[model samples]
Target: MLPRVVRFDLLFVRTDYSDDDAWRDALAAATAVHPSNDFERCGAALQPVESPELSGLTSAQLVGLPRADYLAELAVADAQTMRDQTVLFVDLNELNKQVGRTFRAIPSQVEPIVANFSIANMDFHEFADNADPDGVFRGFTR
Candidate 1:
């Protein structure tokens, strides 16, 4: 499920298959890789962008803070989207690609919803936990 949820965050292949069978076949090929004999069937939920659950908080706090806490914070207007304005980037597809594996796109994975890039939230504290103390931008944790 995480793979399906994170795949878009990981790659931009093509999720717009007009055919369901085509989509499944493509999904299989996309996930097949070194150490991975095949793709596993699993269930995942799609939270609508406008849905009550995903409506409020900025993109940042959604991950930096816990779901309940952030949801509560989001209930109030003018709330901080995150603990801070810190910015960071994590390449979600690196692990697979390192082994010469490719990533997949999620067009039909969900409706084509556009996120507000104008908003973002972050907690440097959360990011620091797994950050490379050596102060390099190369990569982290392989």
Candidate 2:
């Protein structure tokens, strides 16, 4: 059986606007709302950050680019890790607090063994689809 995955969205309560009413009441108040989009339950594979340089970018710079592609890259990377069983668990408890505020953090984890100031943004789905599929994926998908 596949391990259950959960989608989490949190409101810092410090931001100017919180969509707490929408997501909170719509989904049982378990998720939080910020200026960004909703959070979904991604698989273990979705947790790893493949491009250190890309992942290391500031949220402002990333937002300037095509966010959909970038998110796709994260989705693909995460899916692969789930398949490999080498998934890394990034502690998002603190990072969750930073979203609407300043959004600061470095990726600190043990499994893949990498450390860097990073932010988790899965909004690059478009970039991910356009990347070298072979390297990102063991087998190219149609």
Q: Pick the candidate with the highest lDDT.
A: 1
- As a TM-score, model 2 comes out at 0.19
lDDT of 2: 0.23
* lDDT for model 1: 0.25
Candidate 1: the clashing residue pairs are 15-107, 15-108, 60-121
* Residues forming the 10-long window of minimal summed lDDT in candidate 2: 105-114
C-alpha TM-score for every candidate: 0.19, 0.19
Tens digit of lDDT per residue, candidate 1, span 1-142?
Answer: 1112232222212213234454444334323331312323232222212223433444233334333211211111111112211122222222223212111122221111112110223322223344455322221225
lDDT of each model, Cα atoms only? Answer: 0.25, 0.23
RMSD of 1: 15.8
